[model samples]
Target: MTIAARMDRLPVTRRHRVATVAIGLGLFFDLYEIFLAGVLGSVLEKHFHLGKSELALLLASAFLGMFVGAVAFGRIADRLGRRRAFLLSLGTYSLFSLLAAFSTGPVMLVVMRFLAGLGIGAEPPVSDTYLGDLLPPKHRGRYTAWAYTLAFLGVPAAGFLGRWLVPEAPLGFDGWRWMFVLGALGSLIVFALRTRLPESPRWLAAVGREREAEEIVARFERDAGELPEPVENPVVPAESGRLRELFVPPYRRRTAMMAVFHVLQTMGYYGFGTLAPIVLVAKGFPVVQSLLFTALTYLGYPIGSAVSLPLVERVERKFLVLGSAVLMAVFGIAFGLASASWLIVACGFLYTTASNLFSNAFHIYQAEIFPTALRGTATSGTYALSRLASGVLPFVLLPLLNSAGAGVLFTVVAAAMVLVVVDVGLFGPRTTGRVLEAVNSRVGATTDQEAR
Candidate 1:
């Protein structure tokens, strides 16, 4: 059996669960940091006496760092190894975030945020790819979705932490500083735990380190049962894929699909993410009420992810994505048009739920679609576009929301959602339950073929 077969054939085990949780926790910090800015903004605004422009610059800083990190570390992960990339990124975050706590001015904070954002940007693609490489095909879709579900917990965790800490300066330290310290400390813990995980055997073999791959597989087989006898096939050498191949046949389509998908997806995510609370305030919800309700609304993120967990394996991944996209357009429009408080809240919940489901589907899908030799690069490259789009959306989406009203703003979001439906519904292939090599082979015959 090939490495893909052995990987797919292995049963879920404690070791696999540990790896997922550790990696997922690393991603958890990333999301926490993402939402942290929103929650911490008021306090930060006061401490620095920041103007609107400076605050905007501060919020946008991390995404800029993320863009650089995603592109740079992604290529590094592909060139070096997933494990190394993972450690390097988490380490970068831990060190810089702790440094950020000592920041004296807005300029320093923004720089630190951007630097920390690099790790934040680099982690998800690597985590998703690493999980895909580790989990067998049978368990891959649902399990990875669960990992992301756990990651989404960071949203609520940040909100809750902000609520508790922001009002109180603990031990004479400001709440914001404590938040940074907590985030930094959490990342370091995950980095330490990640040391236990084995490198992706698929990546190991792809890199011409078959001995290392086989050693890891031996440990897996002890719990997963022995893999079927090996079958011979031509090896695809490490570093075989060229960067220019991104614009070629199989990859070109995926690149285009992912790039467009991310543009809309990021706009939708950050648009709603940033705008929803503001919309409430505009609609006359009090500050405390909006904060409370916003927290309530965000409950949908993790819950929605969990709701889709069972469906990951049962549903066709693309169809699930298409279905969620359809709902996002419909409900987002409804949310914008909602005048009643309950109606707006209900629609907000539904929209968030659908968004989480959509995020999970694409996270699993993007990692699944590409060949291992190019997976990190392809996934992260498009992911960087989303980061860029997200960073820019606040500028465009807020203005549209303020001037044109929610209806016009969501109409634009709905239109973007249409791109997702069109791309994945028409062009995307089935990935659930299929072997990674087989899926890659179907696309470009770029991967080593699956055993007969």
Candidate 2:
């Protein structure tokens, strides 16, 4: 079948929506664990008698583990199949989170958190690939945005839980430990819910499980009351997929652009995310006040995602990315400079909202840019680079913050945002309503040769 015809065959159904929600919940918990670490930093310091540098190092360690997990599991997802890979990553992270609660020292905590980060990193790209491939083009932007928006809800959920748990130390357990425990328990719930979910038809087809793929697609069609047109019989090649495919010809430039954008974007993202509360405190707020302010800032994420849902489908993907980056740069600087608590909060709200908007766009953009054959692997590999950059920032940037100031930090972050705007806006092709294969075909012979 022609690419256009295949694109037209996409089924929009209740099953797809159900799958998106289930997969999104799993992602929410995954992100919850990552962000919760920052919330518990002070408690960890008090419990372990850790200095600032030591605490920062512990956070960095988890991100390093995430880098490994994203690259490793991404390949595994592409090769072993998405369902198995998703289940394995989820199980691995949840188990490690539970284990982390029993840590007697920083060493054990760091080790466990690192292992958990590996599991956490594997999920987003894999889930993005799975969701993007399944949804019809017409709803792709909104659905993708909703999925990421749901995942980010975990941020405020962690904040709310931390606000309560950090003070009480329920059951004589460390409040931070409770966070890990709750995360593990939540993962169990996600695992149970996911068992009812089915595999991606696109993935099955890519791997040559045609009958299974057809059956899955048929189920979705039944749910939607409209069937997508079937593609020609897929040819199963010998090579499953490889990391090297990301760097060939047409994809090479795009890959490089995305890598640079992710790196710079994350530097700004982590810079602000890791230090938002600190900035709030530096503005003369008390600890509790700062935490509350930070929580309020994060509360804007879900709201931002929801607000963007209506426009995501209407706007060009690249435009959304560029606009958000510019907004983050502006609000980030404003957030750093504001002296009044109310003004600071307003700036922070805008910054975080813009951050979520850009983030949602990028998640969908990255997954849709690659072919089914290489989607998981490429997304994982590229995203891993961002994680690696983020891992280093805490160690390097935090010290700079101590010596310099919020102004310097925000300025640097703003510069990074500018770079992302330029890279994505200039180079990113319009994938707004195109079929996955059609998007891939535009990537050209270089990517085709690499796919072989």
Q: Provide TM-scores for the models.
A: 0.93, 0.93
Q: Quantify all predictions' global Cα lDDT against the true fold.
A: 0.81, 0.79
Count of clashing residue pairs in every prediction: 2, 2
Candidate 2 structure quality by residue, lDDT tens digits, 1-452 = 53324434666567777878988899899888878777776567678999878878887877888899999998888888787778888998999999999999999999998999888889988888878777877788888788778888998888778777777778798777888999999998998888887877777777788788777765665665655456543332333466676677557777887788878888777677767876665567776677777788888778778778987888877789889899999999888778888888888888888888888888888987777878888888889988899888888777766778777878888998998888887677777776666567644433434543
| Per-residue alpha-carbon lDDT of candidate 1 for residues 194-309, written as tens digits (9 for 90 to 100) | 98889999888887889999999878889866556543433433347578877876567778888888887876776776667666765677644665666666777898899889
TM for candidate 1 is 0.93
Which window of ten consecutive residues has the lowest lDDT sum in model 2? 231-240
Per-residue lDDT of 190 in model 1? 92
Estimate candidate 1's alpha-carbon lDDT, on a 0 to 1 scale: 0.81
* Candidate 1 segments whose C-alpha is farther than 4 A from its true place: 226-239, 442-452
